[model samples]
Target: MTVRSIVKFPNPLLRAVAQPVELFDDDLQALASDLIDTMRAAPGIGITAPHIGILKRLVVIQLPSAAKPAIYVNPSVVQASTEMIRHEEGSVSMPGVTDDIERHARIRVRYQDLDGNERFEDAEGLLAVCHQHEIDQLDGLFWTHRLTRLKRDRLIKRYGKLIRAS
Candidate 1:
């Protein structure tokens, strides 16, 4: 397995909708493995294929353990709660920034396992949040987009100022 480099924000690739996984072959499996390795190497809980500049609907999440790391291929939220929960969320693409965002506390996701078998699981807490976040990537959306326009403008200004300072 190899660790792929994650593309940062403002990259056009991150804005592009990901293509669904069509052929479940060794190449696809290797890509999933690479995603897991990349997430582990970055020491983050989750990553999407678009983060690596691959416009493919794939995501790897290893929140609490290395042993039971999850690979979600073509994942989608089947159900979500109206009652929301707030959590401090960060991203590999937007390093050095974190923000509290409201998300569904519980969700049911339908996705394919490593072998491309269909699976559905109910997740709550961090897992649910992670699922929503990664699925957003597939739709070409990020956590920043979930924020208010004023907040997003401030974040952009901060990033621009920091870049100039550096």
Candidate 2:
């Protein structure tokens, strides 16, 4: 597996809706592995294919205490708890900025395993937040879209300054 370059915000591919994975082959497994490596290199807990300019519905997540990374292909939230919780959210594509985003406290997601077997899992807390955030990316909704207009504008401005500084 190779670490892929992450596409930054304002990239058209980041805004494009990702296509569902239809083949469960070595290539698919390789992409998942690459995503894991890329996410770890980003020092982030979660990442999506779109982050690397691949418009595929794939996500990789490894919580701080996780023993190994989790891969989700064509994941969708089948159910979500009404209880909302706020979590500080950011993205690998847009680094150095984050804001409180309200999301379901728990969720049931349907996705395919590496072998293309359909599976379901319930997630809560940070796991749920991570899944929701990554799913949004698959749907072409960046995490900042969850923020208020004022907050979103401020974050974009801050990110611009950071880019300029670099």
Candidate 3:
């Protein structure tokens, strides 16, 4: 597995809705592995294919305490609790920025395993937050979109300053 370059915000591909994965093959597995590697390198708990410029509906996630990363192919939220929770959210693509974003407290997700077997799982707390964030990426919505207009603008301005400084 190799660490892939993460595409930053304002990249056209990050805004493009990702296409579903069609073939579950070695290539797909390799991409998943690369995503895992890249996410780990970014020190992020989650990442999506589009974050690396691949417009495929794939996500890799691993909580801080997880033993290994979990790969989700064509993942979508099947159900979400009405109760909402606010969590500080950030993205591997748009590094060095975070803000409180409201999300479902719990969610049931339907996705395929690496072998293409369909699976369903209910997630809560931080796991739920991560899934929602990655699913948003697949849907062509950056996490920053969850923020208020004022917050989004401020975050973007801060990010621009960081970029210029670097």
Candidate 4:
């Protein structure tokens, strides 16, 4: 397992939909581990395979309070609560910026474990937002797309400033 470089914002792959993970084998496991390592190195609580330029539907989340990371393969939102919550969201690929984006307060996701066993999870609060954010990435929707045009443009300008300053 290795910590791969994040693909970065503006990478076309971030706008490309990821393919479902059909092979539940060692290679997939290794990729999972690598994702975990890369996420930890990025210091992000969640990351998707797409973040590292792998167009596979895989997500790794390690909530700060959780005992360990959770891996989901081909995760999709099955149901979402009517209640909405705006939470600060960011991405490892985008790196330096975040904005409050409204999302369902709760959600039920259907996905598979590394072994390909289908499972469902009911998540709320931060976990719910994280799932939606990552799943959107899988669907070729970058987090910024959730923002209003003005907000997204401002955010991108700020990002460019940060990049130039660095």
C-alpha RMSD between model 4 and the true structure: 0.5
lDDT of 4 by residue, 1-166 (tens): 7999999889999999999999999999999999999999999999999999999999999999999999999999999999999999988987899999999999999999999999999999999999999999999999999999999999999998988999
Give residue 87's lDDT in candidate 4 (0 to 100).
99
- TM per prediction: 0.93, 0.98, 0.98, 0.99
The C-alpha RMSD in Å for every predicted model, in order, reads 1.5, 0.6, 0.7, 0.5
Which tens-of-lDDT digit does each residue in 56-164 have in candidate 1?
9999888874476788999999999988999888788877677788999999999998788999989999999999998998998878898889988888777777667
Q: Which predicted model would earn the best lDDT?
A: 4
TM-score of 3: 0.98
Q: What is the lDDT of residue 24 in candidate 3?
A: 97
lDDT of each: 0.88, 0.94, 0.94, 0.96
Q: Which candidate is the best by TM-score?
A: 4
Worst 10 residues of 1 by lDDT: 62-71
lDDT at 80 for candidate 1?
Answer: 95
Please write out the lDDT profile of model 3 over residues 41-96, one tens digit for every residue.
Answer: 99799999999999999999999889988999999999999999999999888889
Clashing pairs in 4: none
